[model samples]
Target: MKDTLLDLQDIQKSYDATPVLAGVSVTLSAGETLALTGESGSGKSTLLHLAGGLDQPDAGRVLLHGQDIGQMDDTARAEARRLHIGLIFQQFNLVPSLTVGSNIALQARLAGRHDAAFCTTLGHRLGLSDLTTRYPEQLSGGQQQRVAIARALAPKPALILADEPTGNLDEDTGDAVLSLLLDLVSETGAGLLMVTHSPRLAGRLSRRIHLSRGALAAA
Candidate 1:
């Protein structure tokens, strides 16, 4: 059996008494790819945030590699995220002052796992090798999204949390990028939890789940 990389037990979250996720429980094993499908405000991103240790759940446990991240201190949680989780946000979230290569190396450097050769390979595969000296603003939406993917994968993290990773790209580009992402994840035996509204995209993952009104349902 594969080792469980992420486990969310009865996760509950609220903002100003407005519940975002209620009694949500999910498990992701190593080498699995799970797609999260939901309407707007269905709490998909919120759940990903909790799983990545970016936010604390109001109730229940958020465990990564069997360790309860919710019980960790702020610094510890941050360290956990830096070391084990790679996040690809819809907004690209690149540092404006940094070049593409620098931004891609940020997370790996923070985790003390920087691998120049691996990063170079990722850059080449992502079609970003030539753009390393360019800044985020200089690239198109698709290029920026590719940069985000490269950055997230540079660390070879055990888990990847992607929020609409290809939302800004054209269909062909999105599909190509997702294929590359899946191939890399499989190669590294990492678990993936991706949020996407497209059924076509969701079908590509090994498992699929839907969220509505802050609860989970079978896809």
Candidate 2:
């Protein structure tokens, strides 16, 4: 049997006295592409944060490869994230000082898994080959986003968590990025859980999961 890459059970979170997510349960296996959608403040991002070990659940279990990550200390959790999870954010959080090429290979290098051939090929596929010499500020929003995607994927993690990764791009650019991302996930056999507001994009995924008032429903 294939091992589950990520699992969240009865996840609950609150900001002060107000609740954001309640009783959320989700699971992702290898090579599966799952899209998450909901209206504003629907707890989609909260769920991603929890799943990625970026935030602890107020109540629930977070497991990565059958191990309870919520039980780990902050440093151990960070190590787990470094080794097994690739995170993508809506902001296109590339380092401003690094060239596109450096940004793409940086995390993998930190994880002691940098492969120049892989990063170079990813640059080619994401259409950032020419932009590799440029800095993040030198590229347009779409190009910057491609750099972010390359950076997230270079390490080849078991789980890829993207939080509105295409939110900054226009329709055409977003389509291109989504295609590259889907193809990469397929090629790498990594489980993808992407958070997005666009139904069109979500429809492109293999499965769609919606969050409402802290719970998830198949849509």
Candidate 3:
């Protein structure tokens, strides 16, 4: 059997008196792509954050590669996330001062996994090769998102967590970017857990889960 890249067991989280996720359990196997779809305020991003070790659940366990993230201290969790997980956000969280190439290589360099040739090739694949010398501000929304994708995949992480990564782009651009992302993820054999509101996009993945009122259901 293939090893599970990510597992969330009976997760519960709340902000003050308001609940976000409740009894949410999910699992992703190696190289599988899972799409999480739900309406806004459905706790989709909350689940992704806990799975990536960026946030802790009030109750339950988050495991990555059979290791319990909830058992690790803050520093340990940070290290685990940095070394094993790739994150993509709708905001295109790139360093404004860094050129496109530097931004693409940032996470890989931090993980001590930077490969200049691989990053260069990724830039080309994402259609950002010509923009390598420019800063994030100089690129269009789609270009910036491509750089973000390059940064996330450059490290060759075992799991990729994305929160509406293409939400900021137009329909056409978002579709193109999604295609490139899926192709590259397959090439790298990484497990992808993505949150999106688009049913069309969700159907593109291998499996789909829906979150409703802090509970998970099969889509």
Top candidate on TM-score is 1
Model 3 per-residue lDDT tens digits across residues 15-63: 9989999899999998899999988899998999899898889999999
Whole-model lDDT, model 1:
0.93
Q: What tens digits encode model 2's per-residue C-alpha lDDT throughout 35-120?
A: 99988889999899888888888788999999888778899899999998899987787888999999999989988899999999
After superposition, candidate 1 runs with Cα above 4 Å error: none
Query: What overall lDDT goes with each candidate model?
Result: 0.93, 0.88, 0.90
* CA error at residue 187 for candidate 2, angstroms: 1.9
- The local distance difference test score of model 3 is 0.90
- Backbone N/Cα/C clashes per model: 0, 1, 0
Candidate 3 segments whose C-alpha is farther than 4 A from its true place: none
Residue pairs in clash, model 3: none
Model 2: weakest 10-residue lDDT segment is: 210-219
